[model samples]
Target: MAETGAPRRQSLGFLLLYALAWAGGAMAYVPFLTILLPARMTALVGVSDVEYLGYVTFCGAVAASLAGIAFGWLSDVTRNRRGWIAAGLVLTILLLLAVPLAKDVWTLIGIILLWQLALNMVLSPLAAWAGDCVPDEQKGLLGGLIALSPALGAWSGAIATTPGLVSVDGRLAVVAGLVLLAVTPVLLFGRPRPFPELTAPPPVCADGDVAARPRGPAVRMWLARLLVQIAEAALFAYLYFWFRSIDPAMQDNEKARLFSVALTLAVPVALLAGRWADRRDRPFLPLVIGASVSAMGLVGMALAGDAGMAKASYLIFGIATTVFLSLHSGQTLRILPRSDRRGRDLGVFNLTNTVPSLIMPWLTISLVPGFGFETLFLLLAALAAGAVLLLATLPRGR
Candidate 1:
């Protein structure tokens, strides 16, 4: 894809407001997925937490993966990214509101599956919209801004799970309100720039064509993200359960606070990393450094023996993962080889996101029960290492 001339830089107000909207949407549902749903599953299912979580997450992942692809492709065809986002957000809010009515384990799982599909409908297009509107030079700034999402999501979880606020209906109402509030800025004041009109379609290169060379780094980027995503999914999906196992006295709010702290710490780091990349015009360097640091954190987690040690390791891992992911998200916009099919391509790239959730559940089931969490951490560390290796293969100035 040909790089455009220096486009006008977006105003700081616009970026900040847009970022807030993004973070707000994340806040609405992430708490439910990460903290509340697991607890509900544990209560409903008679089986072990690990077993039930594995099944539920796998099913949700399947729906999310399919919906991301389908909706993303639809956005490309209709050129109606905003409409998809709005509809998805509305549907997701309705589904989340109805979650309190799931009286049984199977019903809860069904709702979660539907929720996942709806959320992906919003998420995939939101992602593609960024690629479509934001200029290349500004992607790093955008990445820094996007780093706020996880922190907000964690804080939202804390609010939702606080004592007296833990009921499904209560949490759902608050979260849905926040989602609407968060997206309002983008919807009302900061409308996304329309994508350029579609011109003649680019010819697809056949196998053995010289045009395929440009895709090599893109492929490596995809693999690198997949590995990091796997490492992240493992910790994110099971962190609450793991913390409780380590310290039975630990409260959900405390765990959520710790997550918030870790992500909050990463916010400035992401801004700095993104700014550095923008100034130097070298995004890949930050990605490599971030990956290597994450591997170290996973190794630390594997070696921990007690709750205190585990918390420290998680802090390290959390901070590193946010930086890696934020930078990776920004750089993705830069490396994608095709501009015409940006949404579809990003949907395929998003397999790295949803696919990891699918596999992590199975990985945990296989390793955590039989081999222990230590073994699982070690395996995740290996995956992070693989990410580092793959990322190192990209040529400079990528």
Candidate 2:
């Protein structure tokens, strides 16, 4: 690999810039289940009878994965990552505004697909930008920043969806508007000083090989992370419904509060885990421990048929998952094939995250309906356990 100079420790200003940008990008993503397409909107579209919304979401994931790969590759080819990022922000804002206006399921699906593609367009390139500027030494901090994105998104989305703040559709439009407005200054004024372009291709191995090969340990680790994410997606995407099913009297505001609390706890845990992994060079340990704990949390949620127990389960699940994800992401940065192609590879790696969402609707709608949420939670627990086993088989390194 063409080694760049020692990675400069990114300043707090830069990290904040990236985090805010990511938070804006996140509003396009994390709120879909929680705020954007709640039951009311589902009923508004008249596809409530069939599971069309699930299929729509699946298609959105597919679009996001494909767009992420495509845009990441294009950013590499063009050597102009910022331009793509700016364009994606603009497009996502516009599409998000259009979503509430869609009168039919097909229109909503179309808008969602486009919005996902636009969001990925920015996300893939931005992730690559991190690898481009940040060195291995700073991976832990970068991972922490990345982990914060979801929490920030959830927090902002909850605020936007608070009752009487705006109608469901109007809230989405406002979210889109706010993201667009906030992103504009960053994209326009907070310009990063340009770095010299890499005139030569990345270096090959000692034997002069150029083809990218998936590292064995890394692939194993990726699979472990993938399974961990599957459990997470299943729980997060359906947790609101799970709450409602468990307590029919639960208000939307209360559910949002619980979700916020869970995320608030998760953020610090993730940051602490990332810092600890960096200092101790014990990346795998956190993942293994986190997965095992998360599985236990899932089991707790399953057994907790009442509201109080469910709240406790959410706390456990949040902490465990946060730790696992932070360590897992840091480890991922260490294992990717090409430092120069971090965006492309990470985008591919992200498939491990996105693909589960594509499949989860099937599990949630088809399987969960037949077997019930308790059985589904049990399956999630099993998946988390499987992640632990997979991680156990991987070779450890600093």
Candidate 3:
């Protein structure tokens, strides 16, 4: 992508606001999908709850994918990032409020489809807004800051599900309120640059030069991300089951705590790694290292015969995966081909996030059920290694 010129460096305040906005976008869905929605599923269909939840999740992912692209393209067409983000925030909150009204599975699924669409409305423009405002020199640090999104998302989920704190509808309201509180500041007081016209020239790098990133590197980055994402998705879906196989005494909350620990610890890791990338002007290097380490963690998991060993290995994989994802989100903006289409292209890149959900289930079913989790972990390690290879193949540049 050709930038208009070198990028305009944003202040620390703007970057934090931008990161919080992205975190808010993540908060919009993570809780509902992880805690609240599953609770609703259990209430509605006790025996086959997960089956129905999977259907809802699959449908929601589809809606999110389409909506991400559509809203991003619309923002590009309208050159109104804040407007789209605001509209999306309102719609998402409304949909969250509507969740309590659905008593049936299909009804809840329908509401979730709408919710996913609305959530992406906020996310797509918000992501593209970073490209518009944040300079390449700071993008790595931006990724580090963006890592707070998932930690906060998990924390929000903890609040929503805290015992005796709230009822089902109450949880939905709390989530909506939290979203509103977190997102409004960015919309009302923040001063991010407006999205430029569709014909805007290529994006500028931070060092007073037009970015020279080509489609080829971006394409490789996309594939590499997809491969690592597959591994992450697999572990997310099956960590509990795999742990249970190691020790039948392990409880769900144990794994829950593990998940929280992984996400929380990864935030600082992402921050440190991002800052290092910024200082070094080598964005892909962290990704390559993260992927390689993640592969090693997977292999460790594959060989772990004890619960303690498994948890330790999973922690390694989890931290590396989370850091990789956070950094990739920021760096993707750097490599994306055009300023005009950054949002739309980011939407395309988001497929790496959703497509893995579709693929991981079938892959896990095919492997874990028959060959056992050892086989599954090994295969996931292969995918992580493949990510490392793809990232390694990228021509060395910032």
Candidate 4:
């Protein structure tokens, strides 16, 4: 996958629409998975909501993983990304509407499972679609732009959860509407110019063995992302609890606000960093630096004595990890296993996101309860450091 002809650049319109559409995918999932599903289960089951919610989440993750791989492969085989993405958007919205209609816990779980499949039908193809279109020259800025997804996702969560603003079913409708607004424009108007070389040129390994590149450094990048993701999953689950352990008087909204701010800051910070990466032609640098800073933030967390330092440290870790993940999203496209199978390979890479949820719970159960968050933070810091090491070994791309 050598660089061939000059880079083909798309207009800002396609880029923005593509990023919005990407963010819209997050809008579809983040609120439903993080907020609506739990709330709905609680409404149905009262005090025993956790049992049902757990069943739904576990099954949904499995469903998403399988659907991501399968649909991604299908898109690659057929060479049709927009068609799948459009179909997925329709199915996803329909499933969102179906969510509120479920009467029983099992029925809700069934909807969630199908919803997961439909959501990936949108996400997996959409992700591959980027690879099909955006050139390497602009991928860094694309990374920056699409960083808005999680922030937007978190914002939608806030809107949905606002007290007395809307009824529960209305909240789902709002989510559906937002998804439509974000995605439909891209399908209707977007015109991405495909990159010439879909798979990037293989990188020289740290030991100067090109054989060790593993299909253009995709394996190392994937593994590094997995390590960082494991740390992120643990923190996402337990950050508030750790904050509570620091100060028992804190309220949930306060923690939520902190998370919102951190996510918001990531946008501008990532934009600058990503644009810098693109101009310098060193796309992977931010990921390495972000991981290192994330480790330092974890160390700060391990040692902070009071809520002030803890919150500040959390902001640091949160911003860094968010930026790292977002930039990685775009950069990963540059190093896919193969152009022809980009979507399917991306599905394999999506394991970094889902597998962490499965692994983090066991990790937290083993460490945090008995040893405290200090130990957990230290361990996570090491993991982030490991990511830095892996990233540093990859060949620096021009």
The top-ranked prediction according to lDDT is 4
lDDT: worst 10-residue window of model 1: 192-201
Among these predicted structures, which one has the highest TM-score? 1
TM-score: the better of candidates 2 and 4: 2
Q: What lDDT is reached at residue 313 by model 1? A: 90
TM-scores of the models, in the order given: 0.92, 0.90, 0.88, 0.87
lDDT of 1 by residue, 1-398 (tens): 23366454656776787788778767865688778777777777755766877888889888988988889889888878778888888888898888888888788889889888888788777887787777667788899889999889888888887888656568777888788778767766775444353222455667643332278788999999999999999988898878887999998789889998999999999999998888888878888888888988999888998988999999999998998898788888877766657778888888998899888987888888788888999899989989999988576663
The stretch of ten residues in a row with the least summed lDDT in candidate 4 is 194-203
Candidate 2, residues 54-77, lDDT tens digits: the string is 677688889988988889888888
Candidate with the larger lDDT of 2 and 3: 3
With candidate 4 superimposed using the best TM-score fit, by how many Å does residue 333's alpha carbon deviate from the native?
A: 1.3
What are the C-alpha RMSDs, in order, of all predicted structures?
A: 3.1, 3.2, 4.6, 4.6
What residue runs in model 4 are displaced by over 4 Å at the alpha carbon? 1-7, 41-55, 102-104, 194-216, 238-255, 303-306, 372-374
Ranking of candidates on lDDT, top first: 4, 1, 3, 2
Q: What is the lDDT of residue 57 in candidate 3?
A: 58
Q: Can you list the residue pairs that collide in candidate 2? A: none
| Per-candidate clash tally | 0, 0, 4, 0
